[model samples]
Target: MSPFKGKTGFKRILNAGGYSLDGLRAAFTGEAAFRQLVLLNVILIPLSFFLNVSRVERALLIAVCLLALIVELLNSAIEAVVDRISLDLHPLSKNAKDMGSAAQFVVLTMIAVVWALILL
Candidate 1:
């Protein structure tokens, strides 16, 4: 057993927060897709605040934007894990990567559709 696994209580929570920060740093630095999504969020999230939308519309707009970021994070993680397993050309690896890309695409489309419906 590892000593790291035995952590609990506040210490565990603190370590987990640190780990999450590290993951974000890694994603921002290493993944161009993640950075691009982050850039999109930077633009859209604040734009949501400025829009003449109802509270619910604003919230939905922000929610979908955040969802895109979440999906991108998951996608980046999946690609990293797949690459770590093997860089060799494999069908399953390609499928996994493609699926992640597809998920991001869907989220981005959702953001556009939601904003369009609310604004126009």
Candidate 2:
């Protein structure tokens, strides 16, 4: 048997919801960009209520923010998996990270456009 198979308890925990929780925990704990986004969302969501915004506008704002968070999480996952394979400055790894960053930027731009149309 493999040495990793010895921990039956860990196996059971992994089979439960631990894996999902662990991913969220890692995002908050390890990803700086995610942490910043969450902070901004915390402020923005509440401020939207007091902004005299319409329901549709509020929904759009929230949707865009959630999309940003989703993109950030995916990017963080990609970076983590790439780092897991190797930490060296490989070209493909750099491309992967760059592409993930680009995706986040696109989402951020969408969010900005949506909010600008609503607020300005």
Candidate 3:
């Protein structure tokens, strides 16, 4: 039987939330980095609101949060796929995970820089 066979009950739950919802659950479940990033966002959001930022600045801040989450989710996916392929520490697999991590770091740096530029 094909994996994509008729609607399973779990599939229905997944369908209800959509892609972003899946991303969110994945973030909270398997990704520790995402959990920390979310905690940071929690702190940052209220601070952003209280700081009297301009509308553009607020928009940029929102953009940064979304970017951070998206990048982290992609990184998590890469790591998951790599691990699923082989649990051994192959150099190429290490490189793939490292590159994904670096991409997340770059996104985080962008978020920080944009927030600083807007607020300070």
Candidate 4:
């Protein structure tokens, strides 16, 4: 068996929660774009509920908004790992970062399209 499978039950859940919180804290502190998106979410997520829309539309709105956050977090992780590997200018590293950025751009566009379709 894998050595990492020791923790189980409530203890595992607590540990997982702690790790997730740590990740969020790290992203909030270190990533400016993450902070901005988080601020946007803070305003938009609740506002979504009040918008005159069907329940499915509301859920889709919220889900896409949250998806932006998820994508941002993953992008930040990619950036962190790439930076950790090297600070020197490297083509592969640049490509990795650029791909992560492109991913964010695509998701942001998706959010816009989803909101416009549902609300407009």
Q: What is the C-alpha RMSD of each candidate to the true structure, in Å?
A: 1.4, 4.4, 3.5, 1.5
lDDT of 1 at 8: 93
Comparing 2 with 4 on lDDT, the higher-scoring candidate is 4
Worst 10 residues of 4 by lDDT: 111-120
**Model 2 spans > 4 angstroms off:** 1-17
Candidate 4 per-residue lDDT, tens place, 5-87, comes to 79999999999999999999999999999999998889889999899999999989899889989999999999989999999
| Backbone steric clashes in candidate 4, count | 0
What lDDT tens digits, residue by residue, belong to model 3 across residues 2-29?
7755666988667766966877887798
Q: All candidates' TM-scores?
A: 0.94, 0.82, 0.80, 0.92
CA-lDDT, candidates in order: 0.93, 0.89, 0.86, 0.93
* Clashing pairs for predicted structure model 2, backbone only: none
Pairs of residues clashing in candidate 1: none
lDDT of 4 at 76: 94
Weakest lDDT window of 10 consecutive positions for candidate 1: 31-40
Error of 4 at 84 (Å): 1.0
What is candidate 2's lDDT per residue for 45-117, written digit by digit as tens?
A: 8888888888988988888888988999999999989999999999999999999999999999998898888
